[model samples]
Target: MRPRHPRDVLVGYDGSDNARLALQEAIFIAQTSNARMTVVSVVPDVAATINAVWLAGGDPAQLSREMRIEVAATLEEAIEQIPEDVPVTKVLGQGHAGPVLVEQIDRIGCDLVVVGTRGRGAMRALLLGSVTEYLVRHSSVPVVVVPPPERLRDDLA
Candidate 1:
């Protein structure tokens, strides 16, 4: 049985395979709990950097527009994967994935947040970074970290 307090399950989706697994898990949790599910995608703003580069060379506006379109398409594809019977909502926002996801959790008053972890170790996490780690450290709500699929493990092996 699902907890009563956590009537909402919020998930962060970025079109990654891991994120797709998280979405499936989130749907299961929401179904079992009879809770609402929300899928969120954060589109980082590249305007300033693009503009600066554009001033030097290339078309910033075109690039930015193309990026936005790509993001939207990705989100749409992710949404299509969600189960039709499950009650779900899609949220698209701007900013870094971690902060934006945390903010959305608070804004939506979600009791739990679900994310997929690519299993980055300490050194890699420190150098390359991890969004799951950021959310775990900063989120006000409970966060569930779903590991990559077994197929991924096989591939790695």
Candidate 2:
């Protein structure tokens, strides 16, 4: 059997600390394998945001614009950290994180998918934030789930 070497890598990033760690690991993998890296951030349907903005006495359009700007800024910051030599692309996805990432994995012809887990607890995991779980169960290629660093886990505990 031959060891797998990815030619294209896709990472799920949401600007969280854990996501940053995942991105770092993805970068390392892409660098080692000479793969193109795609960083994706999924923004779910804006209906909830619109409702919240309306309830908060703000213009929904204005809030939506601000959110887009914030998302762009966050992605830009992440992109800046990537080295100059690595071929990279950024994608802004709509809808749920798990489904969107899977779609991107196929669309980008990626052989590996990287995502971060909060490492809150197995019990809690059953209830919320199942992006990593979903990918592990459904990804056709390979999924790498990066948990928070040991120090961060200790601090959270």
Candidate 3:
């Protein structure tokens, strides 16, 4: 039985092929549940670094501006992956990926958070940071992690 309330599905996209698959899954979930979907791309906060560098005689403002533009473009491309029939809101935020996603879930009252996994093996996942793993462990809301398509995996190898 699907919940009847207006579901808010939050998806994290970083312009990766895996992230694009997640967006497609999120759109399907939103369409089926009559939910509103949000596509979020996190831009890591560099203001403190910029400030420190500025105090130390370096200019970081241009770097920050370029980053913001890149993030915006990434978010826009992610949103374009969703079917036009699905309603979605695009958000560009500044922070580390995990915390930023959790915060946005709470801020938007999202019922579920969807993300993508690169399908790394357990050992590899442990050695390298995994955002999907972090969210699965820490998120208050349920999280759906989509694995990459078989063809995509084949292409990678």
Candidate 4:
């Protein structure tokens, strides 16, 4: 069950267009409700990262370190976009998006969780899974999922 008024809000951000939209919505909610806000960016686990780098013809060990650095920079940039009036905390999570976010929600004791849909569609999401789909099923608190803009939605379709 969701609280009538949330005291803490957590948003999953990945520096994507849809994530930016979700961040905006989270900012608005936090401002209006006077709730503390947290933004988190999750990187794939070490094994997953290594596999991806190896498959992409990169140095598995060295590239994973570089990838983490890049992701941290991007997460910091996303944090900067939040307005000064809205107090926010930034977190970098390691592991899959859904579980990492759920863990953050638990750690922060957030009352609401916000994330953007990847727009992978039902079939693809079922096959490969998506963070949004996982949260909808697993999150303990209420979740708000922001979809891509209409123009982008057309492209996704």
Strongest candidate by lDDT? 2
**Decoy 2 TM-score against native:** 0.88
Better of 1 and 2 by lDDT: 2
Encode model 3's per-residue lDDT on 1-157: one tens digit a residue: 9745448899999988888888888888898888889989988889798999899987798778888899999999987777777778888988888988888888888889888877455456433236787799888988888877786454334
Once superposed on the true structure, which residue ranges of model 4 sit more than 4 Å away at CA? Answer: 1-3, 46-58, 120-129, 155-157
Whole-model lDDT per candidate: 0.80, 0.84, 0.83, 0.83
Over the stretch 1-157, how does candidate 4's per-residue lDDT look in tens digits? 9648788889988888888889999988999998889999877778876788789898987876876888898789878988888778889988888999999989989999988876565456433227888898899999998877676665455
- Give the higher-TM-score candidate: 1 or 2: 2
Candidate 4: residue pairs that collide: none
| Per-residue lDDT of candidate 2, residues 1-157 (tens digit) | 9988999889888899889999999999999999989998876668887999899998998877777777777788788888998999999887788999999988889999988877566456433258888898888889887878786575345
The TM-scores, one per candidate, come to 0.83, 0.88, 0.80, 0.85
List pairs with backbone clashes in candidate 3.
none
Score candidate 4 by lDDT.
0.83
Q: Highest TM-score among the candidates is held by which one?
A: 2
Residue pairs in collision within model 2: none
lDDT per residue (tens digit) for residues 29-130 in model 1? 888878888888877878688978788998887787777778888888878977787777789888788888888888988889888867444445432227
Worst 10 residues of 3 by lDDT: 120-129
RMSD (CA, Å), each prediction: 3.2, 2.2, 3.6, 3.1
